[model samples]
Target: MPMPQEYQLASQHYESFLTAAREALHLTTRNQTYTCVQATLLVFRHRLTAEQILMFADTLPAVLRAIFTSGWSIDDFKPEFGDEGDWKAEVKAVRVDHNFSNDETPARVAAVLRQHVDLPRFEKVLQQIGPDALRFWGFEASARI
Candidate 1:
């Protein structure tokens, strides 16, 4: 039997995420990329409103959408979105097993996400999120991509 279209699309989406993440981090394995992607998703989600987070997840591919919501807790409080350094520290603290580097890992992960996701739709979703959105993606507030 032929492969189902949904299965093929899901596979393609996952591969695209891994490929971009691996290339960004110069990593050898999708597992390593997955760690970074997962960590980034968690860290970023913590900073967004529940509604914004869901909107962002809706914009992602199937595998990424799953990763975004994996292990999420609805009753959890949204952390304060402080400066970039504070956010990076939180990411490191959240994924100590992955030993997330201060800035590079988040930047690489965000770059990978940008590479795979729909940019304009993402921008629209975060339009109300202000500079937090930009900084989370390792962008300067005024910087436009």
Candidate 2:
């Protein structure tokens, strides 16, 4: 496909995420990876404050950024999730039609997301959400770098 000149970089970023998410989740289709990325982003996005969410979205590649913020409802701020299970459950619920086999999907998705985004910028965004953000994204102290 011939991406527009402006879309080149954005496509590259999305492709990077697609490749990472697909391999991480052991999914076959780019569509499944896309769904996983969207689901994962929604899981994290709802937990963030409005300010943090905007800032984080701005830092993402264009296509992924839109996916991150898509279908968001700010009418009710989501409560802080307790652990990986809580967040994973929400993600699965978002994509209920798909079966997420590995119990570790959330952590694996987070690991792939970290690989794709600009870590320093993401770390700054994470700071706004606090330590729970780090744990929620499955990033440890070492992964912060």
Candidate 3:
């Protein structure tokens, strides 16, 4: 009957996430943090099947769900999960000139995200998505968060 809390407070939640991400990444601005977070999410998105991507997005907070799905092209080629270095390269390539993502971006973003989401549910989805997804988010396949 009424609007959801997530919708009502979407801006607050998103700003809080950006604040946390900026602190975790040691960045000075939300724009920089946004680019880094977006890039990291895109790198992971490119590795998932369309269905898996939707499943993963479902576990995210409202604003993050929006971020995850924004600009997605179902027809785009899915990339294989290469080494961690490859992941970082892809993340940093998002907006090459403005991107500030680094080697620790994915793991750091994961840490911040874990604090904001329902960890058990998130981990469960990651598990369902398979081990590579777990590793992409900086969790060991057998590890429980």
Task: Give each prediction's root-mean-square deviation over alpha carbons.
Answer: 3.3, 3.7, 1.7
Task: Encode model 2's per-residue lDDT on 39-124: one tens digit a residue.
Answer: 77787887777887888887777888888887778853677646677777777777678645355677777888788778878877
Task: Write down the lDDT that model 3 would get.
Answer: 0.88
> Which sections of candidate 2 miss by over 4 Å?
1-7, 99-101, 141-145
Relative to the true structure, candidate 1 has a C-alpha RMSD (angstroms) of 3.3
Candidates in order, TM-scores: namely: 0.82, 0.83, 0.93
Task: Report the C-alpha displacement of residue 22, candidate 2, in angstroms.
Answer: 0.5
Per residue, candidate 1 scores C-alpha lDDT tens digits across 1-145 of 9986655799787887789778887877777777777777787887777777788888788888988988777665466777767767776676578653456778888877877777878776766677788778755667653
Largest TM-score belongs to which candidate?
3
Local distance difference test, each candidate: 0.75, 0.75, 0.88
Which residue runs of candidate 1 sit more than 4 Å off their true CA positions?
1-8, 100-102, 143-145
lDDT of 2 at 121: 80
Residue pairs with colliding backbones in model 2 are: none
In model 1, what is the error at residue 57, expressed in angstroms? 0.6
